[model samples]
Target chain A: MLASSSTRPRRVAGFLAKSAPAVISVGLLLVTWELYANHSGIKPTILPAPSRVLEQAILNRGALIDNAIPTIRATLLGFACSLSAAFVFSVLVDFFQPLRRALFPVFIVSQTLPLVAIAPLVVLWFGFGLAPKILLVALVTFFPMLVALVQGYEATEAEIGQMLRAMGAGRWRVFVLARLPSALPYFFAGLRISITYAVVGAIFAEYAGAAKGLGIYMLNAKNNFRPDLVLAAVAVSAVLTLVLFGLTVLLQRIAMPWERVGREPSGKGRRG
Target chain B: MSRLELRHVRKAFGGLDVLADISLSVGAGEFVSILGPSGAGKSTLFQLLTGAEHGAGEMFFDGAPLDDHGRHFAFMPQRDALMPWRRIIDNTTLGLEVQGVGRKAARARVAPLFAEFGLVGFERHFPAQLSGGMRQRAALLRTVVQERDMLLLDEPFGALDALTRAALQRWLEQMWRHHRWTALLITHDVREALYLSDRIYVLSARPARIVREIKVPLPRPRDPTAAAAPLASALEAEILDILLNPQPFKGHDDD
Candidate 1:
């Protein structure tokens, strides 16, 4: 018990040591921005001081949070839809060779179309509501996940597949027992890449047209010459991305404890 | 009764014949080793047995013709082939799971054998966390857990270090002695063939046919050391001669 308790602080120390560089760099960037804004004496409409931005953020927290709800809702709903759709699409592509040959090229072509170019069209079709924002988020997040899942499925060790088949595992069983589990790490990697885009995609959708959201709020703030409020919304977006990324990392930790344990030094000498 | 029989079996990849008129058998509860040089269709033989490759001729198990090659025998490939994502116990139970056994029941059944297989305390560990030997043991356990009539082992210890290989060989012999599962091992190691097999079949180069078959008269748990067993040395030398200088065909005329 004593040993276990002692190791907890040591683990915390290790974590801090590992994270110190990133924290320090971000702190320095914030300090530089604050110093520059304070000394330049620019008009607040054009370039607000960091303190002014913080003060505006505190004063308008209620309005900002109300707008944030719809944005968060759209992101989560869209992400969930993309996750399931990507899984199904990846499985189909993996199972059917002709479909892969036909649809994979189309998927690549779709990705080449810029989200900015497509967002307005989606909003025009789906209207200025949650539907358009969710559609845009799903479009932006689907492809990376599908590609990663396909790569993961293909990367399953051939020998293991053969072994499973010899043991009487059918095609679906082989996929579930071997392919699906192997694809998880890649799936999570794709999730991490695509999740950061989800909020931004929702915001772009909202910028095109929306009843209320952080994107519309920012547009109103910009038109009213409240640069501080616009910047505050941007900060909230960054925090949202960080929180989602942290959640993905946490999910990975819970789902794959083996990967973490494998990397630790076991201290046991090699056994013959 | 013979557990397995390959009667005049033949296989060809397109026009390139890999196994020409290969015939062999393993009696019930016996250990047989097939020794061959690389590219001698040793793996092809396993592919045929596992229904991965189609071949012409009869394959019988326990006096009945095998309608399907896959269901009758469990197979271990050259590599450990344990799923990296699964815990050791889960990986070992994969065969049973695929055979329609419930996961909990399969785990319950396999849990007791971990100690016997030298995999104690690793039931919850991943494949990457174990050493090479442990992975192979877990793989072997996976193969055996299916409770099939026979096992097809394709150089299961080929990738291990020399010490680990020897140790696993002893462990395998002990397991086989206890369970008496009919097993066919494919290897090019002459000493390994002599030490573990009740009989050995040596195959020639490409378009492999059984060039020689030697029955081991040595007793159980045969000593592998050169000083302890003269008969093993003699058998090893005989098998080595056959492998080095394969005799030309005597009766068959087709080249």
Candidate 2:
């Protein structure tokens, strides 16, 4: 009874300590914004208070939900395509030297092209359905995961690879057994980075051209002089990005359960 | 005839010669060790044997030319090198899975050896979860599970603490006594060499060559305390002398 009682307070303290910075900063910022909007006599059309935004979001709950579904679907589908393609391309580049040499520079160059600039052209070609948005999201998010996987493959320990080869394991076996597992941490790191971009990419693609999405809703709200609705939609997108980021972390935890075991301090001495 | 033999195996990296005319042989089921100082090219020779590097050498396995340098040996390096993402059982079965065995079949094959390796109840544990000695044992289990014709161990206990290293050395002896696997070990420790090998080859510092071949006629399952015994002490002193004192190469026994 004593242990349980003491542990509950300790756990709560730990949680509070971890989240204190985010909570304090965000709360302060929102309070300052509320005070400025009220005292400065700013027009609500130009600067809606956080309260007005929250109220508008609640009032338009049905429209918000309808739009959020399509955005979520497009983001997930596009992210999936990006993930599989990155994996396949990474493996091919790892296995084939010529392809890596020929295409690596091109891949980097592809990243340099402002992805948003191309979104409209993609929409022009594919039409303003889900295709262009999915394409844009996949295209924009592919590079980080690909880079992570390739680096991860390279990060494989040379001795481990040699050990595997000495066991009569061929190239594929060495890759599957050693290189692949070594890359998982890097892959997850890449996933975390890409998942955030995935939502932003989806939103940007919608901004270019889309039948319905937060990007379109914000645009419509802006034209109607309803800044509150636009701010509400922006809040929703931020929440969406955060949720996807958390899911990526959860996936990593599940995929690499061994990583939960903290590494023991290696004992050191003269090598025999 | 020896089960494996190397004749005039030579390797040089640019201006530095790592191995110069080193030749050795090991009979079937014999435990042989190569002893040398750090950076004496002991590991280089193993790398060459593993086909990770190419060198001018002739290696024979079972009296046939060893064209396929790696197919006959299971190698265990200094570090455990366990995959951090895999469970202990899966890590141990890596070799079998590489050889095209189904994952389930490979797991079943190595599951019985976990207990023998002192890894009972750790079949589901990760390498990070195990102590240093346990990880090393798991590495050894990974090596032996292959059932290759020979085992190449590069300072298998080199990374552990003194107590853990001693415990593992004793455990290895007991395991080897029962299995009688043909093995070659590379190490720098004089006592470790004296305790484990049927024969020990002393190699010279860089541009390493076999300086002397000493036979260890000590009985099986030798005690770690036996280093204090006269015969073992004398052998240890002699090996240490050879390692510490550098003699000018006279080419007295080239072959």
Candidate 3:
């Protein structure tokens, strides 16, 4: 009876502990900003304090909301394009070795070219609306996804593959049963990196030139010398990134509940 | 009639030969054990039989070559090899599921064996959740669930603790009698070989060939006899001889 009673509360406590890192991080940054504003004696227009920023955020919630919608839409659209493209390319690389061999070097070389250098080119080719940002996000995200998939797929044991073959399992069955299941964790790991890349990449492209998005807002605030506004836009971007990445985590939770149960014992972290 | 015949079988890895002109026959419904020391190529022979690799020479199942009528037998490895993600029942149903049985139908077939093997309440439990002995039992169930006439076990209990190993061996003896299967077991344990087999084939180290064939006539449920009396001493002595002096009967290059 005692054991059963404590379980729910323990679970709640455990959840709070897992979330501690993100909370502490955002909290410490907020505190630092408040202190810096207090000590600097800067004018509110140039660099507003956290309290002033919050008041402006509240007062301009209408404006912030109007801009946030377009930015969120672009990020999601770009992320979707990036994911679908990476998945197809990864499958292609896995299926055809010669293609992978030829393209892998090209991909490495592509990464060496700065996004700043390439974003304008992508924007010029695809135009300003949504296509260029989506294309940029896909370019940034695809490499890590492809590399991760190949590594995960390659790590499947030859012995297990042979065992499946001996069972009279077909090639597809061997892949689905052994290789696919083993690669799931690695796939999720790649997805986390891809999601962050998607948002950050989209924003970077927007900074190069976009009519809308938080990147443009940051650029406007920086030009006007409103550090608080820049910081506010940054805060919104961080939260947006967190939401996208958190959604990936939640998807993984639903997809692979067995992972959490098998991996860590209760109360193992140093959160307290 | 012989259920299996390894006819003049030869296997080589590049310059090194693993099985040299080996030949053996197993009678239908016979409980045969292949007993040999470690690195005796016993596992390699089993792998050949199971088609883990293609090799020279004919491996006939019931008069037909294995190439002609495959998928009629099941092979259980030394390790459980259960997928960590799958539940015990799911693991048990793997072979049938692989054979195109629906999940519901396959799981239904395995529902009966759970009670018999003390796995009744643990159907939903994953392989990681089960003990070593339980995992082996689960792996064995996967093989048997296929309605296979012949079962090839490769040291299925080699990883278990002594007490659990002995208990499971007795359980296996019962299971074999209750449900007759032409079984070929590979084990290095002489007592286990003597306890479980109708006949035991002792093989020489690398490029393994049969050095001795010991026939155990100790009768049904031999675990009792194996545990007590002169029977234990005799089996121990026979196994000890191979361990103490293995030079004269050495076969081919050491594995």
Model with the higher DockQ, candidate 1 or 2: 1
A1-272 per-residue lDDT for model 1 (tens digits): 88679889999999999999999998998888888888888688898877889999999999999989999999999999988999999999888979988988888888888877898899889899789888888888888999999998888999998988888778998899889888888988998999998989889888888999999999999999899999999998889989999999999999888887777766642344
Top TM-score prediction, candidate number: 1
Query: How big is the positional error of residue A95 in model 2, measured in Å on the Cα after superposition?
Result: 0.5
By how many angstroms RMSD does model 3 differ from the true structure?
4.2
- Find the candidate with the highest DockQ and give its number: 1
Off by over 4 Å in 2: A1-17, A263-272, B14-16, B102-105, B252-255
Relative to the true structure, how large is the alpha-carbon lDDT of every model?
0.88, 0.89, 0.78
Whichever of 1 and 3 has more lDDT, that candidate is 1
Interface RMSD for candidates 1 onward, in order? 2.0, 5.0, 7.4
Least well predicted 10-residue stretch by lDDT in candidate 2 chain B: B246-255
lDDT for each residue of candidate 2 in B70-166, tens digit (9 for 90 to 100):
6788999888888878888988998888777899899889988878898999898777777888889999999999888999999999989999999
In model 2, the clashing pairs are A272-B188
Better of 1 and 3 by TM-score: 1
DockQ of each: 0.58, 0.43, 0.27
- Candidate numbers, best lDDT first, in rank order: 2, 1, 3
Error of 2 at A246 (Å): 1.4
Q: What tens-digit string does per-residue lDDT give for candidate 1 at B3-97?
A: 79888899999999999888888998999999999889999999888988889988888888887766789999999998877899999998888
